[model samples]
Target: MTGERTASGLALEVLQQLWLGGVRDVVLCPGSRSAPFALALDSADRSGDLRLHVRVDERSAGFLALGLSTGSRRPVAVVTTSGTAVGNLLPAVMEAHHTGRRIVVVSADRPERLRGTGANQTTVQAGIFGTFARCHDVTAGVAVDGLSSLVAQACSGAGPTQLNVQLDGDLTPPDPDPLTWWHRPDNRATAQLRQAGDVGVQPSVSVPTDGEPLPLGPRTVVVAGDDAGPAARMLAEAAGWPLVAEPTSGARIGRQALRTGRLLLTTALRDEVERVVVIGHPTLSRPVTGLISDSALEVLSVRGRSGVATDPGRVARVLDVVPRVEAPEDPTWFRRWQAADERLSQLIDSGLAAAQGDSPRASGAPDLSPLAVAAVVGAAVGAHTTLVVGSSNPVRDLDVMATPWPALEHRFVVGNRGLAGIDGMVSTAVGIALGRPRAARTIAYLGDLTFLHDTNGLMVGPSEPRPDLTLVVLNDDGGAIFSTLEQGGRRYADAFERVFATPHGTDLAALCAAHHTAYERVDDLGRLAEALAESPSGARVLEVRVSRADRRAEAAWLRQLAEQAVPGDDPSR
Candidate 1:
């Protein structure tokens, strides 16, 4: 090791120490102040010690890092220059905070003397993310041991961490003192701690230990929310209870899992649900919210590593883990849910198929409704594929349309359900796709608004690492989600079109052309499936033009179908 240090030497050591702490991916946005990190990361990438991803937009880089960390289940670092570039990371950092993603922000800053002195690209970078990320201020002259300790600490945290490094004098490395990736002993204990920390920090509370068994007398339903693991399904199956899992929920598989649980909850069965076992964070459906909110039902929420549990109703008994059932419930109870769910599922499928097959529109074109689009995308996912569902209508539609597979062996369905916001979804998918390079294919189903919001994610440098992702953009020309909500009522129809449905007629093909990305428009469901079937080679956009005009009417019709399938008055039909 050299006795005298330089900015590049410090940056290289930081990257080396971070790699040792289990960080395998780095997202770098080029900047003058952050040149040392850029060079250091390039060298690391060349040495094959880590994967480096470059993005011009810090916001996109942040989400890309978030996705990489999520997909890899390891700490990922996003490097940025000082000032607003660091602040641009707030959105992704906020999401990581709730989702428990290990995103390490390496924001390069001017020296302390330059800060608060109107220096170029310098500001109070420290503690910029506030509570969203734990911040560590690194000044010049910091020892290698201290830097390594900080890296270790940053790698093991509840959510995101920030290393605001201040560099002065020279930002570039001398030709003879090039930084290189060095070998280090495998610190298994630290690696394990980093992995364990991925679940997020646990809250300080006295609750039953993990794997505790609970009595099985009450009629319980397992509500598996986004990112909820298979434990939710296993618990439901063990207790012979119905599993109401969201589309992104890892438990959205197996026979016990209901395909139309959200809609089913709108039926008489909701009243009969004496107890609810919730896992992960549920943010998609209002019916599930109403069920858990009802004071009449007992909500036993499984505590997630995010240090918080889903207690939207504020009426919940938090548990350490998904409790085991002492004994299975009566076969009759499970059988009834199965029968009702089967009937409702059939109605939904038939209704969607019939609507797509025989449109009532004057144009005679098959109306590729959002729900129908979701169905095709969901069905197209093979065992080796990873489906990244966007928030809003697409995810909600998938929740209703996706059929529960008997087992989730190789396929994965995920979304940014932490904030449930539509921002950064495209870059998130790209990160996931890149991180999972071995996946047979990666597909992202997103609404038009969500896709447009992150179109900058499509701006990939020619030399930057690209993901083989097929982005299925359901272009309804507006925000269709609000149409199915209270805002879409007849009395509010006057304001609905202008405020709620804020349509933007952007030419998607031209937009993709600007990014130099492959673009194709699919109006038929059959062609959409065939397009998805083709092996993905590089980043491309498949735009499916759909109509939001009938969203409210279709929503009402679906609710009517659900009610007719299983009347609210009787549960034991």
Candidate 2:
């Protein structure tokens, strides 16, 4: 493992150090310059040293790594060649940056001397990810001599990091092989790397259990955003406050959680809120963000791992941990919210049912509406089920239609809510399923456009490890999320179809066939339920065709229902 190392030898050492630093999964994108890394990673995977995922698209590979880290709660690596291949990782890296996932990006670059020499596939690789990820440059000399320290530095971050390795001539491994460097003698690097890994990022501390409890006198509410854990619901319960939890929030499963809270916030009830306890990243709803930004309300936020607490008003009281309640508040306050939430929930249900039509379809199945699709997908989640939701409309629809499960049903829900963009969602979902093998089931609720954005994610090698995933795509033929926004105003109606909707009539079945993945089209609720109930053989797409024409109307109708159901008075005061 020592003297006069070749580029391939350096690549093996880099991988060995990465493995020692607690990286168990690697996603490799194919390229000529990265042959050394690809070969080394393949050998490592074959020898059972680490899991390897191969994707032809670097962007997909990057997000796949992010998803793996998210699912496994450990560091995952994505390797790519030099040039724009490294640039393609920026989106996923940006996502991992805000979400606090450790996705290690290893870019194989031409030797340092190749820079400014008109070399092919040679451009600036270092610092390509900007502030999203810190880059560690490694040349053949630096790698052979101080590879351990470099890897330790790369693995120390709370979020994503990069290793731009400059490989020299003879990128492929020589005779005899160098992948056994981990099994070589005097592997003191392992112990050192483990110690370095121990020095890795620690979770942000919230208010301790013994910490001073927050006053229960105010008309408080817990706003649980994406990734907000059970603490938000527990706090709401302890304080006798309503929990307004987004779908991806782990806190959305309990009785205190209000299904119609988002809509309810738009009512007169918002004026009654005196204080807000915020948890996780809440980027889903305008009402929630508006509430947080309101200068009149006192905001208390539980700190997260991203080193930055979510404080829209810039005046939030940051808690070191989830604070306890001084005492339970009077039941009257809770009852008002409960009554309003229940009434609104009923109204929402009736509205959706009517929109979906009272009479069943010719097939005796319920109508195919976006909310209906989301409702079916949400209901499918059960014990040991991992639900990965896509951003835009699917998550928002799920937030509205999904019922709050009882506590401790073991439903793990997640999404790329850091930036909340529609990029690489398919790959992210696939990574989650592959990463958590023991889950009873894995289901992803995605929009048609979102599904199309990362079709390359379905391009798994036949020999590659495949996850049993059911990807339910709500195909409305366009970006239906915009229909609910101001841009969908009557004044913009003519321009809406061409610009905002951007509908592309893609044949999803044909697309799935191209990827060699199983496909199903569920036009009714009965069929959707049946599809979800079946055992997952491998990754499959359940395309549910919804209507964008009704999106605006349904949204308006729901808002009107909320306004009517919830009285506009501050009853608590």
Quote each prediction's TM-score: 0.93, 0.93
Off by over 4 Å in 2: 1-4, 143-146, 176-212, 359-366, 569-573
- How big is the positional error of residue 93 in model 1, measured in Å on the Cα after superposition? 0.4
- Whole-model Cα lDDT of every candidate shown, in order: 0.84, 0.84
Model 1, 204-259: lDDT tens digits are 22223367787878888899888788788788887899999998888888879988
Model 2 per-residue lDDT tens digits across residues 84-196? 99999999999999988888899999988889998898888898888998888887776344778777666656788888988998977766555453332135765765565
Error of 2 at 1 (Å): 10
The ten-residue window of minimal lDDT in model 2 covers 199-208
Clashing pairs in 2: 205-320, 206-320, 206-321, 207-320, 207-321
For candidate 2, report its TM-score. Answer: 0.93
Q: Considering only N, C-alpha and C atoms within 3 Å, which residue pairs clash in candidate 1?
A: none
RMSD of each: 3.6, 2.8
